[model samples]
Target: MAVLTTTVLRLEKSRRTTKKLKDNVVAYGFLAGGLICFGLFSWYPAFRALVLAFQQTNSVDEPTWVGLENFRLLFGDPEFVAAWRNTFYFTGLALVIGFLVPFALAVLLNELRHAKAFFRLAVYLPVMIPPVVTALLWKWFYDPGPGLFNEVLRFLHLPTSDWTNSTNTALISLVLVATWANLGGTVLIYLAALQGIPGELYEAAELDGASVWQRIRHVTIPQTRFVMLMLLLLQIVATMQVFTEPYIMTGGGPEDATITVLYLIYKYAFVYLDYGSACALSAMLLAFLGVFSALYLRLTREAT
Candidate 1:
């Protein structure tokens, strides 16, 4: 009887092992295609970019290794410092003008009891428009003479000023256009975060005799702090990579006032035909952003 029981137990264990192996094989089969696609498309290109950063290529011959020469040339360029300065300036201006506006609009929109969907759609309509179209449209609006903005200023008896034509306002003009075009997406994201907040918190705040601002300061801000922080990082990154507005609208003109890092990168690759320098700059930008991301993650983790 003991020998028979041992034989049955062995049979059961073997069956279970076979079932587990089959299940693992099936799971791997499902994952294989996506893994291959990511390796081929994403990982391979990233690795190639890293390799290319140290090499010189003209797209007609074999790439020659230049070590740090490309980086040295990039650092020596006059526009390098200006590009970074302008990029930081744009980022700061964007934070000042763009960041808080969306959150404020979101909070206001959240309080609205009627036509909420219509208001949301109206705000987001600009974001759906093509960037090129937005640039062209805003370029016309910024025209020094007879432009929409100037006309409005004229009607209001205010002094007309050069919008994009002057070095003084070129960067700010680009920022305004950028803020208008991009505000919708952030507003929607903030609105979504606001909606996720529990109503009971707001009720408790009101019961404590908190005013609107007090409720927002204590309840709303705390509840959406994570989303706000994440969006702030994203906005900083986006503003740092700004190229299209300055490219299409100002052409980095008005004494290079609107020249940004990405715009400089574009000029290196296309205008100067210096792909190596462009790649080197790209690698540097990637490293900086990587550090920023790591720091942000560490800070957020510690806070939590």
Candidate 2:
């Protein structure tokens, strides 16, 4: 019987090999097309960016290779350093405040006994607003003199605060706007993950007399760990690359307090006409995110 099974397996393998060889032309044709497109857009551009990072361009004419001058200047540049600091600070703040809120909100939304669609829509409505419009609206809200924030403070006799203008609060203010803008998407993601969890797990936990918190701590969290990691990594990348809010609202101003990584890159490329330095900065950002993504992938693979 064992010899017969081995013979059958060999026969199947031979048949499969023959079929694949017969279709080799079509397979190789598709592979060639894929490689061409990938090279044209992804691979070639990536290599070109690295090349340009080592070269100088005045935004016209041929680029001149300048070796490591761009990287050296980038490291020594004061504005670049400040932008780096602010960008990391924003990412840290958002990771803490932005990461947990949406998950909690999603869990709450999932538990809704009535008006579920209304609650979902209400939470997601702000995300539908154009980013520029959202930035402008927040600018109005955070306005020191006549803004709603200060007005509310005065009504409640709380101390009035300079939100966007004050260096101490500008980054936090931007984080608030980011959290508000992104909460809906995060909530939706968590909702889907939460719903994907099998009902039988909860039933078994309940039968074991597990309290609600106990069940959530053990079952809910473990089941959704993959989704949590995905969202966390995505937030890290997105928050690290933040530019639009500061660009539109502060102009990297209030004493350059709100300038972020991509903001610095923008200044290098467009404002300062140093495309080389900009590419170098971009490469650094890519390196940072690559490390994060690699770690996540390793952890995920090990778990599975």
Candidate 3:
């Protein structure tokens, strides 16, 4: 009788183990296609880019290992310095204008008790348009003669200025176009974050005689600090890689005033046929962004 009981228990355990193994096999089968695609498209390309950074290749001949020659050439170029400076300036200007406007708009939209849907739609409408379309639309608006902006200025009897045509204002013009096109997404994100804030906090602040600004400073900002930090980092990363606005609108013209690092990389690879230097520059940008992302993650984690 004891032997029979032991045999039955062993059979049940064996059945459970087999079932578990079969389930795992099914799960792995489902994941296999996605894993293969990721390896082929993402991982392999990334590894190749890294390898290309170290070798000089024109795609027609035997590749030569150039070591640090590409980096040396990139750093010594005057346009490289100018490109970094311009990129930084664009990023800074973008942060000053683009970053705060969306948050402010979100806060204002949050306070509205009527026409909320309409307002939200208005804010997010620009994001629905294709980036190329937005760039072309703004390019027309920036035209000195029949441009909408200059026409408005002319009607108001104000001096109409050369926008993207001049080196003085080309970068700023691009920044404005970029800010207008991109802020819709940020506004929506901020609005979502604002909505997630508990109403009780505002009530408590009001009970303590906090003014509107005081409530926002003490309660609203503190509650949404995490979202703000994350968005700020994202904005930095996005602005650093800015290419489309300058590429489509300015063409990095007006004495290279609007040139960015990414634009420079594109020129190096395609225009100059120097893939090695382009790859090296890309590697550097990737490394910098990776470090920035790591620090951002660590800081956010600690703050949380």
TM-score of each: 0.91, 0.85, 0.95
Q: Against the unseen true structure, what C-alpha lDDT does each candidate score?
A: 0.92, 0.91, 0.92
Better candidate number, 1 or 3, judged by TM-score: 3
lDDT of 2 by residue, 160-272 (tens): 99998999999999999998988898999999999999999999999999998898899889999888988888998899999889998888878999988899899998998
Clashes of 1: 0
Q: Which tens-of-lDDT digit does each residue in 138-245 have in candidate 1?
A: 999999998999999999999998999998999999999999999999999999999999999999989999999999999999889988989999998899999999
TM-score order of candidates, top first: 3, 1, 2
Model 3 lDDT per residue over 30-65, tens place: 999999999999999888888889889875776799
Residue pairs clashing in model 2 are: none
For candidate 1, the lDDT comes to: 0.92
Task: For residue 255, give model 2's deviation from the true position in Å.
Answer: 2.0
The residue ranges of model 3 lying beyond 4 angstroms of the native Cα positions read none
- Ten contiguous residues with the weakest lDDT in model 3: 54-63
Candidate 2 C-alpha error for residue 228, in Å: 0.6
Kindly give the stretch of ten consecutive residues in candidate 2 with the minimal lDDT sum.
295-304
